[model samples]
Target: MGTLNLSFQIQTLYMSPSSPSFNTFTISLTTNRKKSNCSRFSLSMGNPNDTHTKLVPGAAGFLLQDVPHFTDYLDHLPIVVHKESARGVHFRRAGPRQKVYFKSDDVNACIVTCGGLCPGLNTVIREIVCGLYHMYGVRKVLGIDGGYRGFYAKNTITLTPKFVDDIHKRGGTILGTSRGGHDSVKIVDRIQDRGINQVYIIGGDGTHKGAAVIFEEIRRRGLKVAVAGIPKTIDNDIPVIDKSFGFDTVVEEAQRAIKAAHVESESMGNGIGLVKLMGRYCGFIAMYATLASRDVDCCLIPESPFYLEGKGGLYEYIGKRLKQNGHMVIVIAEGAGQELLSKSLQSVDQQDASGNKLLQDVGLWISHKIKEHFAKKRMPINLKYIDPTYMIRAIPSIASDNVYCTLLAHGAVHGAMAGYTGFTVGPVNGRHAYIPFNRIIEKQNKVVITDRMWARLLSSTNQPSFLKPRDIAEAKKEKYPANGILDGKIVKTMSMN
Candidate 1:
């Protein structure tokens, strides 16, 4: 018996708006070992809780040398995390021998999809199954039949590599999907009953929230099972991730609808084409689609409110565009224009199983208004309203999405195998990493109207501002007079003025 001595040097580079700081430290370890034995061990940079520690390039590259080099056969591998910080954005990458926390051959893994169907659900599911079977040599993969409910409902189907080999050629999940199954305790009970060690939940924000609860319940029960999710928002509204699965397909599909609308509108005398995209709380789909398809004349999103009837409002803008060019194309998100048309925030007597409010149909509402606005005119106005949400979401994903979904699935599986639970495999700066569930659900991602993307969209479209800057200033003045309001008297005087 002898001893082995290992020494490593760590160099950290801090980047900021002011300057860059470079620091280096050396770490060494010595342990007694048999001369004939090879150590099967792993190296960690620093304490996981130390958010300030930054692992520089040299250290990461050195650590890569010690890991297995099986990634040579893979076409695309995750890049390395060069810099780490807490203040702003961070980059993440994977090493050759990333940790596989669940290393047993009999590990039971369940895959479930929740919420609506997207373009690449089948592709992700198939990749997950194949990765588990071939890479990790795990043969016990189960597909939950109907999302979260399938956990407690005892509806599952055994999945194998052969079963999912050609699934990527199809759309939607073979296991099916639904919403409103947030029974954490019951789901954990089902996991324990089946002896499942890893669960992959594929869905949007709501599904992630449910996953967080399920993870918490597993922890409360003192269980070791891991729960991971792949961000499935077709709207691309998940925060921190550069893009979610199916978003590229969504933008591509939405372009077709926009092209059709443009052709139909340009063919008529005073034509207008209205398109409503799927974005409930965010407008990434509509915004990106408008930018991609340059035929759009006006773009309205939930992040930017529009007026129907005032100076420089939606109605006036459409009328002006018709007079100028004889045709107009307007792209509006499904969640857009709700505040302007609806008197209250209440849903229109419709609720889903998840208890979410069914959004009012903004497309139909705007369509009727356009007709009424031009009804009395002698010159005929032809307005086409298109809602292609289901059609777009049902189709197959493009090449870009296929690659992105594959990477997301791989990242999730790696995280789950490495004992990383309660996190979603999302991208930061176009690299896949395990993003915590709380960060995903803490805040909603929305289009910033002030950003360059929105500015480019507005300039490219050349549409009238639905609500102008001066109008916003005047509204603020009307609410609060120049002279401070002493009481009701000041309000009355301001009204008189």
Candidate 2:
């Protein structure tokens, strides 16, 4: 009995009975370089007795196999109900002693996808579901629809290994997710009723905050439920963890797109191709692709201002590149700045149940601005911008990273069963590892950006700095061409329209 279901939030259909419900969609997400359908899950109905070696990819074409299996640790993996778990007796004394027990048969766990879409969400979902059912002997893994809102909703789906069997390599999640809308009352009621023993959340910065809140609520309820969060998102903004899952895939795909775009841009001679990559608040996607595709002439990010006052910044840079360099390929983040911020801010007035405003589309606005800029400044300097937004976001072409997500998910299951609720299994220092829950639940992980990295990105024409990891700084500056005016003596000037 396969029970496969996707978690795509209801698209303005309002299927849930809740009022003023959060958009329960992507608009509330912090903008990032995005691509593909990015739709977001699956598992077997039951676990097989055979031990299989799942190969998950690490950075730079490395593969991690087997991973560590936690099924043998019966102490951590238990069959329980009502907070009581099944444990074998070791030795008993003649004197009377208190016997403690835990009730299992419960699933008060919450998992979510946050920030932006990443490949392998479905695989992660599968490992989680299978681990709970087969090893822990638990029942019912609730899939929260539309991210944080689903946790508070009249919306959720019951998951099993059978439910997620076919989605190992698919893009997005079977449980739909959103950025905010973590209402305590609604969430508390649901967990209390379902007897959820633990909660696991998957996301980056914006989404993880909600995880912290829900974890706190679990404690306040006097329930023994443990809370855990998995660090997801292509942006990889999460700190403390070695690397958030999905980032490598995003960077890899973005690099391919840039390579393809570069070949096309070079063929056109003197044309400027502006390819938008995924990092909205950050530049991981764009910058990494720029580093990968040295052929790219320029890169832009939200951190660095490319278009100053719309008249002379990015437009001037692109114009100069076309006239002098003969061709250019620029990588930019979707959440990038443009001359069109305030205008769009006035147009959209929708809010989530939490009363937060929706974010605007900076990618489209930037595309329009670039078209208008080149059209007005220089004579039809051929300009093109490829929005790999949904393309990379929803990509299911290959499963190198999906396998890794599954392994991590499997590791998470081991972690959870080890009474290790509240920790996200992740890579540590380039190795497979676990980031405990204390940082996410009990403390605030600071969002830090360094001075040197910022300076290099601003000055370099090659790559955006924010996308690179804090431990490394490899992005180089880009060089732009200055067109020379020819009347009598050749003089450099902004190319006239």
Candidate 3:
């Protein structure tokens, strides 16, 4: 790398003895002026008109320390970049920049939220509105009510900084939310009618899938519109992101459920506390809460399946704990161990509006089982079953979540104005970047059961490995009776003693 010389004029507060009338001093760099790379520069400070003023000794220390460097952008990249085939190497820095593709006065933006309510939803809305208007001079921002249906349903309110300034203090989306209504054609027609050039869709994977469809429809009509998403998976199941907006808040809120369960178990004589968390397909929320609370005795997640009635099963675990400690706390995700309790998905055929199969009631199901087993044994047991899924989802975000939502919104606005579409603002190795919807929804993110986080959680709870290494082999070798439950091999092991 070569060097470049640049000079700076500084207005110093101190007055020089020889030139008391001169308030400004000129600092000139003595280096190769034609070169591009200037890692270090030497400064020569003196009055402009007076050649008699000599350069101060060691004056370049403060001047050189304040100057910007050429390799500053490299620090933004990940510490360790996983090289795939080592072809077409490049660098991409994230954050808002001045250059944009859209004209500030002519730009029209639309904001829509979908799926369930989550913490930091209002904070994200406030930041996007503030960023578009204050940062990009965008004035015609509209907030869509409900989810994808808001596009064609003609439910919108004009968004202004004054209107959204106090929304971050409250929970839920100011524009409201809903599920389903992912009609791409109708939504695109509405977007065109309103002259909306940029659309910010905030929701989970299903909502992002809908946004992708809408973006495709816009392209099919040969229109120049931008569609971006802010991943709002409260369960933290979205792939490629370090953590979703509401995850930290959910972990903080789920701690209350654990606390309550612990208190109830201690109050009763030989009590068992069972708390259920929200995680339809993954168990990030449950796992994080268990790890954070530090009061839980056992935890079950969707990634790791467990038996209900077999040897060394959940019931036996609870019984052993009650005999040992007289009080126990158990945390289970709402989606965990469902196949062992509910009928096959094919046989039940129940689904919500988002086409997701309704999860079986794991919380109540386990409570009943624990009660029945203890009742059969003629043992007096008090088991508290608490489900705080909706309560945690409806609360406002904490300080950390508010900051995260602000950054995600800023990244979304920058990417949209830069003409990037069909992508969501997600973290790439802990730095914010635009990840395409296809890459994000390629496969649902789940907690790695073998990872260090799980190991740490197991050590904290001191629970036996319900899933032994030989359990898979033993499961495959075992035969199933035709009359018993046949959801999977795990269900076959749930035979009653």
Candidate 4:
């Protein structure tokens, strides 16, 4: 991994101390950069100089003095690097700027949460409200009652420090949430009507798309509104960011369910405990929980496909595990084995209000299948199915997530105040950065079956990869279409039989 050394000059506009005029200065710096998909990494609002409207001249005194700020105009964090390209992708480092586009007292902001519920929602909401009030001295903040539709359909509530002081201790959002009521025109109209200069939207992929549209509409009308998104998903599927806000909390909470399943399976002879977790497109939750709880014998996820009734399929693995240990635990992500279920049940694909696919209950279906397979073999097995999808989501965030949510909320507030619109805030490479909405919403982050983490999970469970040579070939082609080369030795162990 060779580092690319680069040098560039950053032109910045700052207020002159001697005169009441903005002066431009150029600073050159040479540093090492990595290669990635840099094409879409730039913010959608275009150049920061063109996107911002000048604040009142004397309002510069309101800038926070104690807090550290990113004085450099070119401060950015590179996204994941790949060997294919030397051009590195980067996101603007998220924090307060020395000079802001909006005045403190003149700013009017609104916060809204859309899409499904997740842990740390209320915490993010609370931090955003409190960050504006205490950090920037912005007093007027309104909470959009529901999701996007609330912009025009529902009433707004005044949010203050006292109002959101203790909301972090609670689960869900105080502003409430919904799915798929996005009307960009109506939403922007309400923001303009209510004098909202800063709009904070919290949700998953769909909500961010809506925010991007709202930002576009606001920009088209030449409004000074800053639409910031805090990516929220229990599945940890949002890309560009290291992970979403509620992911650590969800992974922490999922352990409780896995522990119970382990206890149940260990209690009875030939007991099979099946646990289903939330992961619509990816199996991060299931993979992480299984790794955390070493009791799992097999972990099934959407990325790694598995088939039954074969020589070395899921049925054979389960039988072998039960015969060896007398009891076994299995964890399956909700989206895992969907193709198998559809093939067995001949079901049609359906979507929810937010355009997310409606997933069938994999736990129950797998449990039945295991029982049927064992019964035909004259084997008696007791199966207990557990689904903790909502339970984990409805709980308050853990200690680490609470702190993470605060950082995310504060990052969003700083970006919006600095006139960075159409961007979402999250940590890229362990540093918080403002990511464009298109970058995050363009593709989903999935558990890479060929990655070391997934390999570690498979090694821990002592389960077959359940992947054939064709699966390996497809994964390699999809991930590295340009080179047709995979970094790992996954293809060598593809013999499931």
Candidate 5:
């Protein structure tokens, strides 16, 4: 393998109204690569001279200092100071640029939503359409219906400010969505045929992978199309971002189910309430919901392993809690304790159309197990199980998520217009930045059991950690290395906040 060297300089100008002066800060980033399986850690762009003229209108007062230059970037590892090696990873800051590559009159943009339904999907779609029309004087915008297949199969819907005016008030996506319909060749061909120069893809991990393929194909064909992705996942699993779009809404909506479970359990004699939320590989939903509810006695997630039959296990903890409180509420992620289910049921693993594993209904399985365990002890228990998996994801976004979706959509639009390609837009460290597709899709972010947030959850619920000595050792190894390097790549510490 050969080393890939990249260098960029950022020029930031600070101006004060009273002082009538400005200060400039120039930061340079140079990275030296030795060995890595990941793709190039830089945002791809079109011709350097493509963007030479300022096209955005009605911003004459602050355009000179407000617009970010092409060289501006955000350091990926801001806290890490590698004194020995003059190498650092950085991402281009996402915002309006002084110069734009695509002329407003010549630009034709399209947006598509793929994967499962999520809260605020329509909010993102509406913002993209409105942002382009109102920000830049672009009039031609198309909505790709039915995901990737829509690029070639279905008819396109023309989007306007009036058409998507109140879409944010509605749930789900107006463009429609599907899974496992990616065909990069056909999609790019249709894009070329239709003269669409900008593409915005909104989806989760699998959908982002498909977007990466489409971007590569466009780049290979020497097309001028810019591909941008807005990460969307109800599970909050996408890495390198503060949180996914629908995550807050899902967490908020999940509280309704938890509240109902608490009410049902508290009303019945020797009552037990079990609520399952949406989390396939991560336990953020379950953990956060439990902490917010403050009524749960026990919480189970995939990151922490628990056995039912052993001492200090789930069964013993439940018995003790019920005996003390007379009623108890338990929360479990969808992916929690899958190995136990698999071994007990001896079922074969299956996958969905999007290559995701079809998870067994752990909510029902565990409820049955708890009933059997109490029955053997000649104990009477009334257990209420609530699975709000679909309900939480299908509802409209709350106030916070609606504002967040608007910012994300605008960031993506700015990047695409500035000729940045193969990137996703999201808040990194609370500031918006354009991240390469390879970075966000490299790994799924999971809830860190050893983090302070998990500790807080345990403290609030008074539940056992359900962790063994070996599990602790494994978690330590899984965290970011002390040297700020992992597998020959610089990585940020995992954060649950």
Candidate 6:
């Protein structure tokens, strides 16, 4: 085991609009290239057998070994962070309060929770308000109602200690959020006139570009305003942070749902279940669930190809399940094989609350296909459930991620007080963290998803993440050998792959 190195800086290279073509621009971040540098975060776990333990970062997480760069590593390392507007602004914080002038402390800072809600949002917001007023001694903490729309329509009000006193354990943000708000010159002017020097935005990646627009516009007006982004998405797709706050909650929730499906799938004499998770373009939530809950016969993700025919991935899984336990549960990410494999995406009509195209239920669609495939033989008893709504996003409380959220929130407050602007706080090593407030408007993060994660996923595929026990229980007597998907195939994969 050796020292851990996992810090990076964001640098953006391009941007494009959503049309018949790509909607989001590719981004990047620079991390210390240490293929040979071992991450000591995981090595602290003294022994592999301990079930109840905590592994801190920079401990004994890795072992020293000669390393070589992969052929496609550069392709995956394209984007980490990007701020289209803030890269061009500069404003010193107003000095400490004087009778004739207001200090940065006097300048108000407010946070708005917007767009479709995700897990762990309240935890982030709670830390913001509590850390801001109590720790920093800044008085006003505004909670804008209904997201970006609230900001545009001037539907703002002040938040207080009483407002965030007990919000950490809650599900949704007290300020609420709307995806409809537009960032405009008029909006930025209003924010400046109101004496708000800093604005905290907590939302998915969609809201980040808008935040950039406001910061840029404010700086253009020669205002000393700073804006910070807190990433929130159940998909856990954001690239900069080692992992977003809501990811744990979403995975926990998905694990529970998969367990239920597994139980039912196994109870039947002949059965099959397909559990679909909510993931649009990113497969983090889906991949994490598969890793956490090993109950599924086969796991499918959008990042990688899934084969349902012949004797490969999907077909073999069902055949083995029927031979051993007679029933099996399958876990899938909604975005996995979307337009090509998901009926939800292929449906002629779909829409969400705000009238956006509905990301249909991938679970049901997969289940139908399995049923159709096996029904001709009269051998399958299939049941399916889509973990839609708030199942994964409404988790109660988890210590590991709760601690991470607390640190991020508290760190953001510190950043504000220290006059750190246009930067974000996120975990670096498992324990240590970093800040990315640059010297000036600069390139955004260059964060591209790494295939290392995908490789780990493939190697672990046959081993069956935490699911070997249930898989063994349901697996039929191995008169035939498909050594790949059974026991001993699983080696320890305790880290967040």
Predicted candidate 2 versus true structure: per-residue lDDT over 352-391, tens digit per residue: 5433344466656776777776666656656666778777
Candidates in order have lDDT scores of 0.72, 0.53, 0.73, 0.76, 0.78, 0.55
- Report the C-alpha lDDT of model 1 over 305-408, residue by residue, as the tens digit: 77777687777788888999999899999989777566734545567886566788889988987788678545579999989988999988889989988888
Q: Can you give the lDDT of residue 402 in candidate 3? A: 94
Candidate 4 residue runs with Cα over 4 Å from true position: 1-84, 480-497
* Model 5 regions more than 4 Å off: 1-88, 481-497
- Residue 165 error, candidate 6, Å: 0.8
- Model 4 CA lDDT for position 13: 24
- Model 3 lowest lDDT segment of ten: 484-493
Question: How do these models rank on lDDT, best leading?
Answer: 5, 4, 3, 1, 6, 2
| Residue 339 Cα positional deviation in candidate 3, in Å, after optimal superposition | 1.0
TM-score of 2: 0.62
TM-score of each: 0.80, 0.62, 0.77, 0.82, 0.82, 0.66
Candidate 6 global TM-score: 0.66
Model 6: lDDT to the true structure: 0.55
- The true-structure Cα RMSD of candidate 5 reads 10.4
Of 2 and 4, the candidate ranking higher by lDDT: 4
Deviation in angstroms for 491 in model 4? 49
Global fold similarity of model 4 (TM-score) = 0.82
* 1-497: candidate 4 lDDT, tens digit per residue: 34332332222222223543332222223223334342112232223453421111122111100111112233232222111222224345677766676789989999999988999999998999889988999999999998888888759999998988888888888888898988888888888788888889999999988887888787667676788889998889888678888888888888999899989988998998899999988999999989988989999999999999788898998988988889999999888888888888978778888998888888888888899989999999888999989999998999999999999999999888876778888886577877767777879989888778999998999999988999998887765211111111101111111
User: Which 10-residue window of candidate 2 scores lowest in summed lDDT?
Assistant: 88-97
